[model samples]
Target: NNMAEAIASAIISYKKEYFGSQADVNYDKTLSSKAAESTKSKRIADNKVLKARNSNVVFKVQFAAGNKKIKLNPSNFKGLKNVSVRTRNGSFYKYAYGDTSDYAVAKKDLKEVKSKGYTAAYIIAFRDGKSISVEEAIKL
Candidate 1:
């Protein structure tokens, strides 16, 4: 319901005299103000969206690390379908549905992947892929 309507309903529902000689109208005003303040405080808190300190951190763990595949934390790579891995030298590699398409092609095209200078790689979702530079990836 609307905030104004809710506040009005609360004022009406409060168990205090309204029309009698013992009616406490002043108390009703204080109660309404307190409720309004509480609701406003809650809304302000909920509106805040916290951002991650390290945005380059690729939560994915499973990737072909040379001949031997290396998997980090299983929970980190969960529900990841399409992903794009970026190398240190501004090269991009894409994979979908657990398919690592043409590792040789990626390795050849992305000179950074082959170079030891590559600081880090990012495995982000294709839908909401995180776009971060090599410097940021290294921080992750």
Candidate 2:
């Protein structure tokens, strides 16, 4: 189809017009507009994750809640990974799965989590990694 050649030509033209000589030197790295955009998006997402570690409010599926600490691993979590734990006053540990700011994504995760044998799993919200009501998280 020569699609790659066409895309390369387009990218070179775009760089020559918009970014000039310096961009031409880096043109091979970007390949196409979509690739350039994807790189930019990845950087943005990485920054968000860094920020989320400290201040972002996110929704997660709480699959296990108990006073005792259970080691987090695929074996412990029914072959599922990406698990995290939150505790209150060093008293109770809430084991949660998935981490996203999108409520819809959290809902979807909840459904999958239940299907994984965690029938009682539900969506929970956290602000700075502390438990908060779903309604409050949405408002924030």
Candidate 3:
């Protein structure tokens, strides 16, 4: 009988030390380190979403392209530091220019590309590494 009493006393003290004596009296006993960790994880996920929402919108001016290697060269297209030759849908070579997150800023860049002989240059946005409509990118 004495051994049983000592064990019970030890368990109660352990609970009080970890969960607090108030937790013992509560109807719900879900308070634990694991629950605290779950709350922290949810907060971390919410922070990521907020960061994505605040990210700058990006665009590029597609100047030229070809199903195969272009007759011309991308190196001679423009001197923009952000100019790049990217593969579209893994099929064609596309020469694009400019890097801006603002829509109005991209329009100004488009004008510059047009002046450089890329009259058909246009603005396009990307999301998660895939191209999307500028309208859609703005909405996001």
Candidate 4:
């Protein structure tokens, strides 16, 4: 019975993999079947996470970091548009300019950001709204 349960689970998994979410499992009261259903659901969730991580990689030119929140306005950012803020911890704020997916464009924006007297401006990358290393962003 154990072997039968294991084999049934494998077949259900295979169907889910090849047929996508349309592959529905007929649930039974057995414990093994419930376990298989849980496993399949977890796999589906993992796949979704992977897809999200691989998409939406964006680059921004970080121009300021401080412990206080600055009002996000053109006057606050030396007239730079498309400025955004990412908060660290709870109170600390990092101000960045430009939203772009092109690395070359971000580098260009960094130059402009530095010209505005933010001499230490640098490029940062994010995937799925979480900060990621630029090197890792490049690989993604």
Candidate 5:
């Protein structure tokens, strides 16, 4: 992906440089305007693409506690792959099935789960089974 990005950038730059050298007055003005417009359009497109790629897909977790609820964010767990909710006192609970259910269970468990200073209800971007920055994940 990096290589592809580099090549695409080179091509765009090459086009800009090549077209910037027109001899005709009208042709040069038109080409320059078009190039500038193209560059602006590309920048906007790139921003959208980057935002989508880096955007995080968050999974909320909630657990039950008496009649209350506890919400757990991604940071609550060290390894989030096999997410499960259990009591901090050493009692294993059931695994949350759906995204909503899992988040609910995690929220409920938050009361018992010790916090390591992570925020609640935020997005988490992952790539190749490894966590990535939100900006990078948004590209996906």
Candidate 6:
């Protein structure tokens, strides 16, 4: 009796943690083993939301930010992967480069980008698509 209850609770917790919302629980009550596999399958689905396979936080170099109609070109940062431009507020756009889950790697990346002519580039971290500091990102 408690086994079913335990499985249900575990599934619910896993769903809420990974999916950010409730999911339809339609598993057979008699199959506790199947529930475990279902939970593992769900983790795979949530992997795309992650920055790195293991890290929930990552650092990027914010090369530009403005409220004007100015365009931000992530393509300008050549040879860099994970280059992206995201809007924080409704209007202001922020351009960033690099996707590293490690703080030391990000710090080194900052230096490398700086040397490559991005003199003002700096590290800005993100977890689940929200801006954070390198220190905070490392903690996550």
lDDT of candidate model 6 versus the reference? 0.53
- Tens digits of lDDT, candidate 2, 1-140: 45575467557644443433421122224334434433333344444432233337898886765556789988998887889976655655667899998765776787788788876565667787666655456556
Local distance difference test values of all predictions, in order: 0.31, 0.62, 0.53, 0.63, 0.34, 0.53
- Measured on C-alpha atoms, candidate 4 has an lDDT of 0.63
lDDT of 4 by residue, 1-140 (tens): 85687568668744543444322221222235544433443344344322223558988877665566778888988899889986645555667899887666776787888788876566677988887756556556
TM-score of 2: 0.56
- 10 residues in a row with least lDDT, candidate 5: 61-70
The parts of candidate 1 lying over 4 Å away from their true place are: 1-56, 59-93, 96-128
Determine the C-alpha RMSD for candidate 1 after optimal superposition of all C-alphas. Answer: 25.1
TM-scores, in order shown? 0.16, 0.56, 0.52, 0.59, 0.22, 0.50
TM-score of 1: 0.16
lDDT of 5: 0.34
Deviation from native of the Cα of residue 44 in model 4, angstroms: 35
- Highest TM-score model number: 4
Question: Which ten contiguous residues of candidate 6 have the minimum total lDDT?
Answer: 21-30
Across 8-110, the per-residue lDDT of candidate 6 in tens digits comes to 7657744433443222221122244433433433344244333334466777765544444334353455555556776534554555667788555665776
Q: For candidate 1, write residues 1-140 as lDDT tens digits.
A: 56686567546633222222222222222334434543443354244321223433333311322221223343333333333333322222222122222222222322333132222321221213543322233233
Q: Kindly state the number of residue pairs that clash in model 4.
A: 0
Alpha-carbon error at 63 in model 4, in Å? Answer: 0.9
Model 1 clash pairs? none
